[model samples]
Target: MSSKLSDYDYPLPEALIAKRPLPRRDASRMMVLHRDSQTIEHRQFRDLKTFLRPGDLLVLNNTRVLAARRFSDDHGIEFLFLEKLGPARWKCLVKPGRKMRLSATAKIDNVPMHVEEILPDGERIVALAEDVDLYAHGSMPLPPYIGRESDPADDERYQTVFAQTPGALAAPTAGLHFTTEILSEIPHVFVTLHVGPGTFRPVHSETLAEHPMHAESFSISKEAAAKIDNAQRIVAVGT
Candidate 1:
């Protein structure tokens, strides 16, 4: 049978959605699923090391989140940058996506932008009028479920300890539970996967098969690939 969009939907209590990180990076709750036995266990995030074997191979995604969200003009229409098309040109997702017409011009935090093209996937190609300090005025493009505006703390805690590249619109959330102390005990390989905002996009289509999955760029180093290839078990850190 085909899966319906409703089949994948579940009710999440609003209170359960964390507006901010826990006081400690490793203080979150963890659920362990045992597929073979059909058993489940609940534990603290810091207890993860207890379940892993000495020879287990752990792989981490090290893509960093960018301050990609900016207001389009003073009215506060939002543009979440997805990727760089070229120097001073970016592909972005405009909120109220229908409001942006072809050949329209908008200012993002005082940086003038020209709408060059609209892709079939609903992303807009925009050309900047001048170089702007995006980080100075832009905030992290957090997921909708966060239910709060980005604060100063997000600039640091929203990123993982291993993040190195600054392209992801969203954080590799699975890695968010790790701290430097916890990470030091684990032997791991690093890979890059620039997460896009589409990760949180809902499947509006009736069936799951009809919903298109958004693509994100990722790369694995030769050293990381070799380690993964030789490992007895692979533990992926995040989506």
Candidate 2:
């Protein structure tokens, strides 16, 4: 069935959103839902161990979000890099799209970029003049709802403890609540699903069916797959 874009609209009060991560990763609150009993329980993230048994497998997405937001002072432009196309080429979304049309280019702080192609979705295939160190020069691409500029603290807070694989534009937020201590106590498998910019992109269509789903790259290790197959039940740790 089709759903209108407006149908998904709900008021998200700013107070309900978290401006910063908790002091400890496992210190966050957790809501436990019992399907059979139709009851709900509130607990700390560390208490997650109480709900699982020996044969239960916890699968976590270990994809890491890149520090992909960069500002160009020369042209007063901001680039949110999405994908790497080649050695020195990337797909990026440029702000002030109204002024920076096709063929526009910018050179900011010795990092040069040119618009190679304009995609149908309004993103640009950008060619870098040289290999740019996005991690060192760019800021974390934080969600706008957080209502603040990215900071040095976000470099570690926004990432999961097990984040090894990179390419995600956004972190698998559910994984953020876990700590090394919790993972050591559970039987777990790690999977990679590099989150895309679509995590923050709103559906523009009137019907949900008409909205195009964004694609993301993912991979599973043989060990993880074996663990998944051997487990009695699988518990996805992240959304």
Candidate 3:
């Protein structure tokens, strides 16, 4: 049967929402699904290695989260830089799109930014001035569910230990539960998939088929591709 958007909906209590990270990364809860009997079990992240068998090629997304959230003035207007379209032009989503119509401009952190084009789905292609340092001025683009402002600590907490690439608008959050100890014990390789804002956009259409999918960039190395091809089983491990 084809799925409607409501088919994927389930009741989620506000109390169950985790607003902050645990003191230890590996201390988070893990839910295991066994295919043989169709069983489910709850465990800790520390037990992950036990679940993997020999010759399991663990694929990890090492795309790092960009400090993409900038404000016009004290969060009066939020500017989320989604992707760099050109040297100075960026694909972005501006809050209050009605106010910032086509060609609207603003000075954020002393850097001039202007709307170059507007997409029909409420995204805009914006142009930034030379030497605009988002890493220095922009805040972490935390999901709205977090319900708080991004702090300095999120710079470290939101990224994976193996995050070598720098392009994702949002974090590969599943990687956050991994620790150095766990990674050292597992057979894993890195891939890059810089997440875009569309990944988290809520589905408003009656059917999921009606949802407009946005593209995100990705990269895979030659050696990683070879291993994946020869592996007995491939287990992807990221959001």
Counting clashing residue pairs in each candidate, in order, gives 0, 0, 0
Worst 10 residues of 2 by lDDT: 1-10
lDDT of 1 by residue, 1-239 (tens): 64876766688899888787889989899999989999999999999999999778889999988888878777656888777767788888887776776787888766788889999888899889876555566788778888888887888998998899888988898999998898889888999999876786877889888888888889999999999999888999975
2 or 3: which has the higher lDDT? 2
Shift in Å, residue 190, candidate 1: 0.6
Which residue pairs collide in model 2, if any? none
For candidate 3, lDDT tens digit of each residue in 1-239? 66597777799998899889998999999999999989999999989999999999889999989898888854567888877776877777888787578888887777787888888888988787874665567789999998889999999998988888999988888898898899999888899999888876888889978888888889999999999999999999867
Cα lDDT of candidate 3 equals 0.85
lDDT of model 2 at residue 57?
A: 95
User: Which residue ranges in model 3 land beyond 4 Å of their true spot?
Assistant: none
Q: How close is candidate 3 to the true structure, as a TM-score?
A: 0.93
- Model 2, 1-239: lDDT tens digits are 43767866799888999899889999999999999999999999999999998799999998888999987767588789887788888888888786468778787577777788999988889787897665567789998889999999999999999999888988898999999999999989999999987887887788888889988889999999988999998999764
Whole-model Cα lDDT of every candidate shown, in order: 0.84, 0.86, 0.85
Candidate 3, run of 10 with poorest lDDT:
128-137
